[model samples]
Target: MQYISAERYGNSYRNAEKKRYRDRSRAELVETVAETVFTFCAFCSVLAVASITLYMVVNGTPAVFRVGLKDILFSSTWKPVAKEPSFGIFYVVLSSIAGTAMAVILGVPVALLTAVFLAEVAPKKLAATVGAAVELLAGIPSVIYGMIGMMVLNPVMYRLEQRIFARTPGHQFTGGANLLSAALVLAVMIMPTVISISETAIRAVPAHLRASSYALGASRVQTIFRVVLPAAKPGIATAVVLGVGRALGEAMAVSLVSGGSVNVPLPFRSVRFLTTALVSEMGYAGGLHRQVLFTVGLVLFVFIMLINLSLNRILKERERQDD
Candidate 1:
């Protein structure tokens, strides 16, 4: 029988309700602001991608149509500045494909082994040191890689080429700025990217899987190869795709080592990739010549898109299998 005034009780209850309402309002406001920021960031990323695709299409399509896609893509001659310019890019396309394939063949095994060592074999201290080195490698600029390749690797290749071809009949070694040099440089440049992604993927394999494999009397190497790698195949595939993208899009480094000559892709012979071809003449090219360069860009863009789409489908299939 503690009697309270109705007015007093009503006032207290109203104050408590008001405080709860204020707290809820503040929380809602914060949540709304956070949601808005995240949405804006996502929108910006989409907008950027859309803008780039639109720009490349708008600028590149006219050239493809004007030059005749067949002539531009399949023609062997690429004399753009001659009196009668020929805008064939058959060899350029071949060179790009060959260089990328060579880089992949040379780089992937080494990168995978290094990643496995880092993820599975190395002790913590050793892994830390090597991981730091890999990170540093990834941080180095592409131009720096080009410079190093030019100054150091080129001379070594020149000597090797001289030794190999010296015995060949009627074949003389050039300066060793050739498809092989470009591929080697590209392999080195892509190593860090492949290693980092692959190591992360390998390391992400569940601890339980490793333990279970060990419980089944599997050796460490066997467990890693049989259990962990299979589980991480999707991620490894992603790393390979990323490496391919890097190799395909690289211009400056490849141009430096590739001799910038439009020739069929031969290991010891000078060659030009699609990227190098675009870089070589875009400055002075006019009229149809400039348009053809745009077409080159368009072809490159399409190649990348196709590669990504194919890889994405593979990843999805793998995911379904995993599930």
Candidate 2:
């Protein structure tokens, strides 16, 4: 009887040990799997950023060196087909600048007003509705915006320009598709971004600041311009930068509205922006022409980088000031 009992006990102990070992093995496998997944996710993110940046740098640098920075930017002629293609990228740059400037001029006020209305004036329900609309606009595809410009806004602008010039004789309307038209369209496209960012910035300013301004017998307008905007300068600057970046890189809408002529900027003349140049010609271009287009893209990338860097520095300084 004693021998049988001992054998049974030993069998039971062996089985328990086996079960414990299996559970530990499963736990280790789960941990390993979790770690591997996390590592993979991290690697994917790094690879994505690195690949895009690397591609831009590699493709763009050669164009920059080939063009000789000064001549490429300042040269008047951009004939890219000769024994030696004299690639001047300035015409597009001018168009981009003009369009961006017009966008800022038109967009800033409307954005500021919309932001103020949402942040300070509107009731919660009204604000929610308006904010939703702004977000919807932002989510709309660029192609759709371009289509709208081509179909609706372009005609309207054309008529308006004719009327304005007719009434004011010798005030040349230039053409329907010029800097003014492109800028206006760009302004419309970037409005949502500006409004959304500016509103958030304004709303973030301490409520107490406005109340204090009121206590000091300040008008609403005064409080807004003086207290709110100044205090929210950093955030507003960020919003402007964001808007500028969008305007600078905009291709489809600008392409549709801008006359796509490769000429030095004339106030009333239709012209091509760098982005539009790429979109319009990339389909047909090959060899050196293709490289030139890529180089234009590189120039655009550099502009965006500069804006981002400047914004970051300004924000950092603002944070330091606050500290």
Candidate 3:
């Protein structure tokens, strides 16, 4: 090889090494920056949740203390504007629970069947069309649902009530604005969510499981009911919980159809839910009334938390049994 200048050779080697080192440093810096950004995003989410929880607790607890927890939770009468105001929300709470239960009862079976059809029975093209319809249903605004219920379902309910209670003595029909109407609206609103989630879960079941079930001479229906459904129980349970949350927290739609009266949660009677109670009077309310609305929010929060915990526990127990 031709002899090279030592200085030149040394400089070239140093430059090459420097180039490699700079490249490595740049890559490491990019990675660090990316990691930091991801961490910040996660932190922001946690911060948001923590802040909301803290704010609700700080603002809501004082009213609960002032109002007396027992009276606020257990007593039936709610007269906030009266000279001697009583802040009882027992009927509100009951209506919320009852309406949600009724919605679930009416919605879940139909949703399950729809999901099963989409996942297993229906032709692919038909399933795709129906899936699109379901997504469209979900995209429809809650306010629109309320408006439609008010205009369409309300009249139908009024006619039905007229036929049923016309001969019954002393039964007043408030033009079909009642707990049943609210529950029906809630059922329709929650159907899309339940069906979509359950269908996804059902389709996610491993193909091998169904094949094995068939190899064991099980019928198609049997395979689905015993193997696929059981395997997908966690996801289905999650869908149900989501539906419950929606039903519980729904205000505008339920408020429109629920007649806005604080009453025991009879299907035919005008009633108010916890969410409606909060929304109905928050605008004009003052002082303790405002604070008590926060308390209602707090109580609703607790109910959601309890529902989540109970459902999670059930899912965990199911997982253990399956294992």
- The model with the greatest TM-score is 3
For model 1, name the residue pairs that clash. none
lDDT of 3 by residue, 83-117 (tens): 99999999999999999999999999899889999
Residue 144 CA error for candidate 1 (Å)? 0.4
lDDT of 2 by residue, 1-323 (tens): 75676578897766776798899999999999999999999999999978888888787667677677787787767777777777787888887887898899998889889999999889999999999999999999888887887777778777877876777766545457777778878888888989988898899999999999999999999999999999988888888898999999999888887778776665456788989989988998777777778878888888898999999998898889789
Error of 2 at 117 (Å): 0.4
lDDT of 2 at 265: 64
Q: TM-score of each candidate?
A: 0.87, 0.85, 0.91
lDDT of 1 at 143: 85
**Candidate structures ordered by TM-score, highest first:** 3, 1, 2
Clashing pairs in 3: none
Deviation in Å, model 1, residue 146 alpha carbon: 0.3
